[model samples]
Target: MNKYNDYAKKMNCLYAELPEYLTWHKDSKEWEPRKKQEVIGRIFNCHPSDGEKFYLKLLLMHIRKPTSFKDLRTIKGKYFDTFREAAQYLGLMETDSTAEMCIEEAATYLMPAALRQLFATILVYCSPKNPKQLWLKFENFLSQDFEHKKTLNQYAIKHKVLDIIAYHLDSMGKKLQDFFFVDDDIVTRTHDNLFKEIQTERDIIIPTEDLLAIKQLNEEQKVAYDQILHHVNNNIPNAFFIDGPGGTGKTFLYRALLATIYSAGHIALATATSGVAASLLPGGRTSHSRFKIPIGENNSKPCSISKQSALAQLIKSTKLIIWDEATMAKRDIIEKFDEMLRDIMSSNIIFGGKIIVFGGDFRQTLHVILKGTKDDIIDSSIVMSPLWQHLHKLKLKQNMRASLDPHFSSYLLKIGDGIEYTNDKDEIQIPPQANVPFIDDNTTLNTLIDMVFPNINDENLDFSLFVNRAILTTRNDFVHEINDVLINRFPGEETTYFSCDENTYTCTIPDQEELFHSLTPQGLPPHKLTLKLNAPIILLRNINPNEGLCNGTRLLCKGFTPNIIYAEISVGVHAKKTVFTPRITLEAPHDNFSSIPFKRKQFPIRLCYAMTINKAQDQTLDFLGVYLKKLVFSHGQLYVALSRARSIEQLKVLIRPSTPLIQSTDYTKNVVYQEILKATDTH
Candidate 1:
């Protein structure tokens, strides 16, 4: 028992320092720590001793370095046995490891140092002798952490740590419930509440006074709406794709269908590829959140959703599934959902024979695979999915946003369809009316800002108006600059919130300021975040779906606490509702940092005067200012930026003079694969 305890402590110490050493960059031309390795070594008291060396060798064996586990056992059978024995003794591995145990072990080995430490601490406290006392002590340890306090709080509230510990305990033939008096029904209740909100029967009957205000669908929308409604009303199992560019009343049709279904007391599950789009629906959520889609891709695996789960039951009972912005998802994601549905319902029919309606404009963004070629991207799109053959096509051509200016709408459609005339270099000129001329005067930026943000000086200005107007940029640096300028212009006392930076596993990494500087990526709030009263900010994460605080929800800074931000929802159904947002630990993806893992503990709010075009995909702005300091590099970016404004009059484009000139018109590039569209067309 003493030997096992010593082994556990050694294993814990190794994992607590491994993240600082694991990542190797070939470009650096040497093995370099993500942070200062010496600092980690000193802090963790990790030295080049026998135990540390053994731990390193074991990690290499776990990652199957340079060979498969089977091959490694054959090549170094004796070493493999030693590593296996140590792991089993430390309760990190089982003698007869199941598939689930193997997966859990792999995830454990890959976890960041902070999480490893937390897991190790939990394991150390879990005891069969004084089960209840040990459980209480464990809870207290998590709530009042030595380090990584915010991260601990987040995982505790979400029960992520508890779930992991429970899985481990089960592997040892010990039940966590027997030890702790925790409500085992908490997870089930949370899922139930989520589904209840989604299926809530609203007052679908439109008020007689507001009858005239609810505009009737045009001929284009009527055709699609009627077809979809027909399939739903008759209980027919059908798949349909409603294809349209932005502002063609896609949302209007969605709401109408939802209303119709709810009025008839049927369940309609509405989801979107993004939180911003989802928040527009009555009880919308991101597809991943609703469906339990795995973050990392594995073509062979289905979604983590199980047949006996409440979500699966909800899916089975759902009458209609409406997926908005469907084109943004990978072909594999859709196929996986189809596969899971078939398995759950024990039927080979598509999506368990349910009526599934997918809506998106192929002219906009498709699945964005990092470092993938155009061919790779096109292949990953829904148009290339096998399920496309089963889907009936419904088209919407009317431009609701550009109804007053038909010419502008036509130009936008041309840009999206890649039919607009381009020069030999493939650059199309922008029309003068659509372009905001680059002035030599220094006041040009201020003039553009004033145009977009009218009544900025008014103390009693409607906050909603400001929230609806935003400056869209092509880069994060420009966003930071514009936000800084805008906040300085605002008439209020500025408050700076400094993040609690620490390497929870070791004390060394936080001491290296240069390391923190190098690892901090865009889309994440900085260590030092400054805000002013009435400052417009956007939520960086989906904190609470029920309260309308979701990713991309805009808010005005009303007040602040040491660890919480008091803000009023600026957009969505929860608009004007005040909410408190707490600081949380956000980790950068392994791919984001050359495969190095790190977490940033900060407030999940960023200034919203300007945001990247990629971040503005599902947002609809009343007035949009596009600052083209750099040309859009990705597909659908130009289209997304231009289509955000409700009307041409509400849009303004500022192009840097350094950009290549093309006649008197403004030139933008559009990418379209006609072959994919043809493949999706039944005709």
Candidate 2:
């Protein structure tokens, strides 16, 4: 195990996830074919455009790698002056290159309607920064074929194209106006297929389990529930916040509320700031995906929802919006939702006079900024927003987990509340009995793994057992390293898939290309993925939130196709259900992940044997393992990682017991922003 662990530390990417239909460029991670035979192999799976069938056949008969792009385009021993005449080509456009290459390839033979579908696919998957530019550039190619003998003018042709694109975007609960500017003068439609969205909400099955839970609310839970019901029952839409720590039955209260609202045939939308938390709520979805909340530096932009769009109608009809883990979201996100709601509902009140319940613990992790400081993080919290003062704060002080271990529960409170005794570095000394002994790095990790996931290599052990435990660290690097060792020891033959990598900016220096291959930016997956059947993984992108496929969702690999992997949702409400995952191009949210900005095309998943402490938020495990090789650097990170289990007895921690400049006794750093805590205190 140690040998394999050491070997994987130096990543040599030869793992094969898909059949070797493609090969990697030497000394680089770019996805391109150097040989005629490689391109021919790819063409076999996908038919070529006009004038290529005969040329392709002739070339396949005599195949070899070409010295350059010009040589590769040579067909039937004769060169096609331009790349287009060749069977496989990548035409880079100056603006929106990815979207252009995507459309140009399909434009050769696909019908105008099919091209529209391709255009929508690019919008959904590729996420072009300027959709308007792409549409304008590809307008002619997206029109009806001239062979049909239709003599429509340019204006009429463009109108037809817009209608088709609008229809396609509407089906996905979006509108072209979302990506296009308001001044673009899109042909407006009051509504389209939003009835289907409303129906899906109406069709939701209020679980009998949740129905029964309505009667089981504890005393504190009852108070919060009654306040929400009074607001909803009286048609007085108001904004309220529920302050509850982990194991305080926050999700329990959410389900009961959903059941009552859903029982009355009224729509109640359940959303959370993070996917892990969202998956726990019945009919839950991330607030960002559900609301089209913009991501990145511009946190103050309103949601991408159009006023007359289907999502607007859904929001208008929703009787209650319960946002869980509200503390983790930036103030801009919530305020932006509030602004959009007011515009849609035509009201000046907070959240557009809608019944919205924000539930979370300020003691847990707060909104994350890439390099945010103490003041930066506190300023980003919703508590800093002027709207926070108006929120009727409700408290749930009775933690459900307290019944299991009162001492552990109270200890966690002290840690979260920042009342625990700490040294000058603001680091708390953990009880020696509270931590697994740290003999050495290797021994500590091995012990933690054994404690959380025993018999990990046993083929006969149920795979479901692996889903109930995970090793968490504050850094993504640690998670990746630990997951690599654990996956190497799992009981199946391994398959690895290499992602197609390219820098966003034209690469000028050698270091930029190297960074692209190794970069695994936030929200973007890695270039090389190694996996085995039944290996546990988590979704890194929000594919289909309605189907229980969201970021941070846990799944187990079941099978693989040419470029797809089918998996079973190992946890959450959709557990045991199978879904096929397709390769999508994911762009990093920031340029800082590498020296140069880049995008990756791969399956949006990561091994879930371990995950970052932030990603593990909102998830509770019976058996938990935490490897704190590095001190947590952000507010509430230590508290979040430590509180992910019901009791200390069920948890294991592997940390260095010695510090360089100070006396250490099971001590580690704990960051708490007291200013935000003081402002958000529910008491």
Best by TM-score: 2
Clashing pairs in 2: 15-496, 16-496, 17-496
Score candidate 2 by TM-score against the native.
0.75
lDDT of 1 by residue, 1-683 (tens): 11234433343333335544434467975434345545443223222245544434544423322233343333223344544444333222223322222223323223332232323323332222343444444443433332354645553454654554543343222344655446668534333343442344343333332233235878888788788888888889899999988889898888777776765677888788888888777777778767767755453566876687656777877888999999989988899888888888888888878889999988776777878988898788888877987898898988876657788788788877778899876877666765777664246667667888876767677755687889998888888878887887777676766453334334333233224534547657866577978889998876555445567888899875444466788776567777655555676654754334556667788899988887888888889998877777766778888888777788888776554453332565556666555655643
* Cα lDDT, all candidates: 0.65, 0.75
User: lDDT for model 2, on a 0 to 1 scale?
Assistant: 0.75
After superposition on all C-alphas, the RMSD of every candidate to the true structure, in Å, is 15.2, 11.0
Sliding window of 10 residues with minimal summed lDDT for model 2: 11-20
Write down the TM-score of every candidate. Answer: 0.70, 0.75
For model 1, what is the alpha-carbon lDDT of residue 591? 70
C-alpha displacement of 678 in model 1, angstroms? 4.2
Candidate 1 segments exceeding 4 Å error? 1-215, 297-300, 439-443, 455-460, 503-510, 517-519, 592-596, 659-665, 675-678
